[model samples]
Target: MSFTSDQAVEALRAAGEPTRLRVLTLLAGDELSVMELSRILDQSQPRVSRHLKLMADAGLIERFPDGARVFYRLSSDLAARRLVDMVLDLLEDGAADQDHVRLEEVRREREAEAAAYFEQVAPRWDQMRSLYVCESAVEAAIERAAGPGPFDRVVDLGTGSGRMLTLLGKKARLCIGLDLSQNMLNIARSNTAKAGLDKVELRHGDIFATRLPGQSADLVIVHQVLHYLIDPAAAVREAARLVAPGGRLLIVDFAPHALEQLREEHQHRRLGFSDAEIAGWLREAGLATSAPIALPPDTEDLTVTIWTATRAETAKRSVA
Candidate 1:
């Protein structure tokens, strides 16, 4: 997998520009669309897109298509990542201050939007969970699908009410729950404290770019989170990056359905996901996936689907 002289030169040339370097630094934080990049850079869409396309071609970044929109992030390739790291290290102090400031502004705007949504829904979040299926049944299925564990570390991405941590944290030496909503994190904190789970830590975080080290968790859970994301597959890829060798990723979400009302009423970006879609994402993320288990609803409710995948015992790679 060594890069040839020509490939190395091409990569350097691709990353040599100031704008492209700024783009790399921005993408180092989170995946962003062309529009977002343009806004942050105060550049035209076509200009931003050309930079992205060149970097992608040079393997300096990765592009993921979500419907009509495409998101870009730092390349997952090891050599490309190393090159990015070297470039970042060479940046002058305060060189990226402006970009960082604008990034924070964008983040605040996103936080405000999410806070408003969660404020409206926080009181009824758990109640809505009940409307889908029997809580006990779903919890049991999650436990069985996640399997028995004496894991070293566990992380729950988009932990809404801290239910998964309260249920599964006991088996792990340490458990961390991440959420973007301050209200949700507050509820999670209160719930975890009530459950007497002192090892559980809740943090306000972006799921696509958590502070945790790559391949650091023995068990990673993303319960009922995918439907809300603009790019669920990219989120899955992020979660997979956290799985240590021999670690497992357990995802609990709704099976494919035609719940159009959920989009308008609940801010659901997608109705549900098919098994094939979930499996394809897992496989693409370099995990060995199991056949998805479906828990049918008793009435006219959404069917819950559980998928579990394990990182290879000997595999060790970082995801960007």
Candidate 2:
């Protein structure tokens, strides 16, 4: 059954229950047979099956027939996926002692798998660029924040395929691309080199806790990246941490909407953020914030927002 926004909320409320969350944590990797889940979760198969059935009916999961057994996996519903990701992220900081270790191990395994998958797929970055057509928003935000100039230090967080670096190549004295997947970084590095951006640096790292020195960048841009983060606020804080005084931070991502299907495929953290939330985050990071500018109607399902904020002069003075 297709789930709407309201249904997505209800589904999340249902799955967000304590026990049900434990079950999902175990099932995140792949479809788990009922018995396998029961063994892992230490619950009876009947009880586990009941919760799975409810999630399935809620469009949070799907059961596929494989011979005589049915395998349950995450659903393709966007809302369901977002709900799941948000719940998982929220639980990350305060999860139970036992589950925290398990979650960490699972996350490491998942990251490794995702990295490997991206590496294998890196060569196709150029072909995949056209999949998202509205790159103008990203470009506009960057230009508005940092005027055409030769910046000595710049960073593009989550620089998928390094497209933005290519755009800003001539203008940046040193452009660095940071992302989590080696494959994406490899593609980005290759693309940067291909575009003759020999000074561009590609680093595989998490946006939330990158190795880049504090207050290191003259400009930082996180384009179409925040939505994929499990904790966007943390990532924003990190971006703010890295910007030098008088430097700018630009973020372009989807705005909050009712699309629930994005979660399963896109792994979006939140549908998007409200203007107030985005502004508050920038302000907390000591940045002078502005109202989010909404993008043109491209797809009926998703809306995008771009924010440009600058570090406060006081911030620089205090750091100095």
Candidate 3:
């Protein structure tokens, strides 16, 4: 990917500054809100916002809002990412030691908060699963849909409890499980180790921006995670971006229910999703989806649906 001459100069001008360069360096690993940026940089929120605005306007970074908070990350465009990466590569190591140290502390605090919540909920997850539906039935359906394969690389987004990793571990050469909660990651680590999945790797990461290589995963699984996201379609697009050409993405979630209780109690941003809605999202992400397989409970519990979408072998490479 190549940028226009003018765009190259513009991106450079945006990143050429001292503060903006530090911002790019910090964002390379994870997305940060303006408040977090301000805390790490020890700059006023207004000043940090100003730096973010310049980088965003120059296309060196992307800005998004979640509720009342606005967040920024390195640009998702291929050419823009390439330029930012090249510029950051020129900076000497430890160029801003203080900034790096503060950044680590801010991230740790965020993880600790998330860890506390997960720790409180992790024990009840199995009980919740049983209340919603039969856990064994869901696992069997996922395993059958995933197919027995000697996959090169398998990625499990929102890998909570590492159950999926244990199920798919023996079928893959490598297994990577990502979760936002450090406590959940610890659980997954223990569970996978007990299962003897020596090749499994766990990361505290965002599903929307994994930073993993594009088109490298033979299989990508997003099991029962979309309901918690503010934008389920965006999650699907990000998951699809990781699938290798001709590879498949498997999503397991609810099939549209009137479970109003789940919304308030479970932190569900969306109650459930319809098959057509999910298929549309997959299609928009440049994947062809087949009919979804639904497993309903005997009572009025939530019904779990599994949707598998495939990318054509001739599909274009992901931008990032």
Candidate 4:
């Protein structure tokens, strides 16, 4: 879509400032909180927030509110994203060298923090899984729910330990797993390597905004990751964005339950999702959803629910 003159001018004005430009450069790579941007830019939170607000108002960036935290990223507007790309392309070589250096430091700190948390939980991840339904049953259900596909590309969002990739990698020419924790990625890598899946790729990524292009995958799986997110619906929308035309999105998570202990013990943000909630989010994303398949636990544990949706082949809307 062509931008109006006023819109173009607004977008340009928003991108004209040096600090805002640095914000754009950093956000172009990953989603970041206002605090993180402030730390990276060596500016106060108020100052960073002001720039973010202006850019957001001008449609140059998108703000995602996740509970108490809000993350900022380049807008999904094609025109605005193209504008950002053009502006970034015009930067002098090494002009933001220090910014990049600081960004790396920030990333390392994030990695260390995430690594520590995961390290504490990694040994028990599988043990925790056993508390639910049988593993074989869940895997079979997932395989059947996803349908038979020799998909060209497959992406697993929040791919903890790369279990889904290992389970479904044979059906795809290429499979990629994305995780926020480097420790989890390491485990996933080791597991995928053990499975001898040569086409699998693992990347450190944010669930809110990933580095992959829109509608780039034939099959997208978000397995057992929603309960931990502050905004489960937003995560679903982001997962839907990765589905190609006629592609499928498979989400496996827990149904609503009174699992108060899970939150305190496991760091779960939300207890579980309801059927209506999942369906509503899928409809909002312009995907056709199938009836959810429920796998009730044999023991006294949380019930597992699998929701599948398909992106319409003729839809013109971007999955923003």
Clash tally for model 2: 6
Predicted candidate 3 versus true structure: per-residue lDDT over 1-320, tens digit per residue: 67789988888899999999999998886667798889988899999999999999989998865445676878878898988889889999888688879987875664455456566787566466567778888899889888878888999999988889999899999999998877788888998999999999999998878888888898999998987764467789899999999888999998877666664566654566778778978998888898899998646667899999988999887757
Tens-place lDDT digits, model 2, residues 1-320: 34677886778777877778877765564445575566656679899888988888877787754334455777756667777777777776545556545545554654565456556656785665445445566466557656676788889998888988888877888999998877788778778888887888888788878878888787898887776554567789899888888787888777766566654444543566667667877987888886677775454545667788887655644332
Stretch of 10 with least lDDT, candidate 2: 261-270
Local error of candidate 4 at 276, Å? 0.4
True-structure lDDT of candidate 3: 0.84
* Candidate with more favorable, higher TM-score: 1 or 2: 1
Q: How accurate locally, in lDDT, is each candidate?
A: 0.85, 0.72, 0.84, 0.84
Model 4 residue 107 distance off true place after TM-score fit, in angstroms: 17
Tell me the tens digit of each residue's lDDT in model 4 across 76-164.
78899899999999999887889888888886775465456666776567667667667888999999988888989999999978999
Which candidate leads the pack in lDDT?
1
lDDT of 2: 0.72
Error of 3 at 84 (Å): 31
Q: Can you write out model 1's per-residue Cα lDDT over 57-138, one digit (the tens) per residue?
A: 9999988654455668788788999999899889988888898898788757755665578767776788887876778998
Candidate 4: clashing pairs of residues: none
Tell me each candidate's TM-score.
0.67, 0.65, 0.64, 0.64
- Model 2 clash pairs are 77-261, 78-260, 78-261, 78-262, 79-260, 79-261
Ranking by lDDT: 1, 4, 3, 2
With candidate 2 superimposed using the best TM-score fit, by how many Å does residue 44's alpha carbon deviate from the native?
13
Q: Each model's number of backbone clashes? A: 0, 6, 0, 0
In model 2, state the lDDT of residue 304: 65
